[model samples]
Target: MKFNWEGVMPAVTTKFTKDDKLDLKMFQTNIKAQVDAGVHGIVLGGTLGEASTLLESEKRQLTKSTLEVVEGKIPVLMNIAEQSTKGAIYAAQQAQQDGASGLMILPPMRYKSGDRETVTYFKEVAKNTDLPIMIYNNPVDYKIEVTLDMFDEMLECKNIQAVKESTRDTTNITRIINKFGTRLKIMTGVDTIALESLLMGADGWVAGLVCAFPAETVAIYELQKAGRIKEAIEIYRWFLPLLELDINPKLVQNIKLAEVYTNIGTENVRAPRLPLFGDERKNVIQIIESSLKTRPTLPAYKNL
Candidate 1:
């Protein structure tokens, strides 16, 4: 089915066993929880899912698990992002076969040089798959940015249908909306800037923080769409600090910790991506505790 690339798309975490293996049951449970919380979509195998640490077979398992739970209630956007275009294409093909609704493609991370290489990388991947793709422009993690000029060039590819703008620059978002708004759907990936992006004409939000707090995130988007900017901002302020935590390199650890705190998912993550410890671990726990204390209660998961 063709899916609308709008509203809250959670960059979901891949839950793991204490032994660090993929825990399919936990993963599916999390997906169902998000759907129950009313998220518009689910992004499997994204940065937040620690895709780098997962094996090819594990990725397939995750795709299958997510599809089983989602069951077409909402769109399922698979993150087919890897260090090589070949791997990305392979993953995209696998996701499509497994019933993914669309693809969220990131630039090749290994080669971090010229714009020419980046442009070529996207072109090759787009050629390999028929799925509508959302360009994942996150410079901080990938060490490369899809500049405005490169964005324009990639738009020529028919399947390059959308962009998840994580640059945190309102001007860039504004520029893209002003220029290519007709050609592409621009969704803000950064949770903190989601309100600003929507106000400035972004189509939706693909957020990492939404995994831990789906109801709150959905509420924020619904409020904005209802023309309730003041109400949205109030909710945005309550979520800003927790959203900031999602951008940190230690996001996987922090998010899992929050999940544990909320009793939503396991805190286990695969290595060499270790869980936060010592003072850092303590601080994250405190943050989740504090946020829960002040966060507004959702009727569906009131105990959380």
Candidate 2:
């Protein structure tokens, strides 16, 4: 299948075994489920996938494995979030070499660069690659906003194909559209406001909680796109609680917790990250349980 920077694409979580190794089988299973559920694409090794802790070899393995299972049924987008421009270029080259469909590239990780530095870093990587790129801009957490002016400068780099708008501000969606029109394909990166962003004319979604509720995610996107706003909101209202998990700091744990119910992925994570326990665990599960009890059937859109 051909991939545009549009529709419902998931930033899937990286799965780990109880022994703390990459659970490639489970990872592929999760990606397969995403495609099977009609997601427009799959984004691997992103923040949800814990890119910082993954070994270079492991990341490549993920890219290779993801492409195989997806089998070109949908675009398999690999995330490159390295801290150095040189490092990012190398990762992009590796993905291109392995036949990845595209990449979701973050600004230089760790050390927050100012606007000039950020634009330069993105351009440097884009100059060296033929693969399409999605600029991952989450100013709220990354502390380095990829401002519209910086994007104006970034226009010189031809491979900068899309924007993952996760500033946690809905107005930015309209602002981008007003500024550039279709110059940049905009993907809603925040889960909580995904419906609003889609309604505001974002071209796609790079969602985290979709790992658990892939069908619902795709349904909401399709329903909204088809102009069945009322039906889409009906599902969105039921999904909002679980969707809220994606915006929090414990997102990895929270999402995996929801995944456990789906039984496609596990809750295990690397050190500095652990399973949710105590009140936190109970609180998230309670929300998931409450929602499950009243889970809505998909809106039955034939286009799906």
Candidate 3:
């Protein structure tokens, strides 16, 4: 299957039981919601999915459940953010065996390795797995950026075919196109600047807020591709406030709250993370409720 790294692929959050066990049933329920909403694909075990806090078994269960729910209707890409190169390779191979269509891999987390180490790490993992890979380059959040020079070293690994461009600087989207062209699929990883990235010719969006506002996200992308900027901006302006929730260290909690408000998923994130309370909770809830009160109607896509 040729995976077109276009449209919205929500890095779905991991719903947990109160005891912090992987709530596979609720997880499946959330995944089905994304598919039914017409998202191009759904990503599991992502940064928003709280991958850093999940155990190995929980991660596998999440991916397996995602594959079962999606049933090949769309690509089920899993996030692989292991701290070691060998660990990343092993996880990548295991995910392919588990039926994931692709992977969104980050640089060796917590290491802050130099360019040579980062390049070698990604190349090794890409070579070991047959599934397509999207290199996650979010220096703002993860503190590691997959620079274009590093990408030049990656041309040897053809499977490393996509980049989640979260540099937070919009021009990097253009920079990637100027240098690599179609060799890499550029997905706007940061939510707030997603519309801008799409206008700059981003191939797709590995979105966070889309988990809550899927229809709006897809509509903005469709309208933009159809050359309807004024229309897209109208929605983008409305969505910007909610989209701002996709950034920062507490994004998992913030996005999970969005899911709760939309009733697509629960906000039961695991430990080391807790539900928002008091002013923080009220502030986010206020924003989401206000947006819901005036949500935009989605126009039909060309094909549909």
> Which candidate number would show the highest lDDT if scored against the true structure?
2
The superposed Cα distance between candidate 2 and the true structure at residue 139, in angstroms, equals: 0.6
Ranking of predictions according to TM-score: 2, 3, 1
lDDT of 2 at 207: 89
In candidate 1, what are the lDDT values of residues 180-274, reduced to their tens digit?
86687888988778889988888899987788888888888888887877777888898888988887889888888888776778889888888
The ten-residue window of minimal lDDT in model 2 covers 295-304
Candidate lDDT values, in order: 0.83, 0.89, 0.87
- Kindly give the number of clashing pairs for every candidate: 0, 0, 0
Q: RMSD in angstroms, all models? A: 2.7, 1.4, 1.3
Residue-level lDDT of model 3, residues 118-139, one tens digit each, is: 9999999988988989998988
Clashing residue pairs in candidate 1, if any?
A: none
- Decide which is better by TM-score, 1 or 3: 3
lDDT of 1: 0.83
Task: Supply the global lDDT for candidate 2.
Answer: 0.89
Score residue 99 of candidate 3 by CA lDDT.
84
Q: Which candidate model has the greater lDDT, 2 or 3?
A: 2
lDDT of 2 by residue, 128-181 (tens): 988888999988888999999999999877778799999989999999999998
How close is every model to the real structure, measured as TM-score? 0.94, 0.97, 0.96
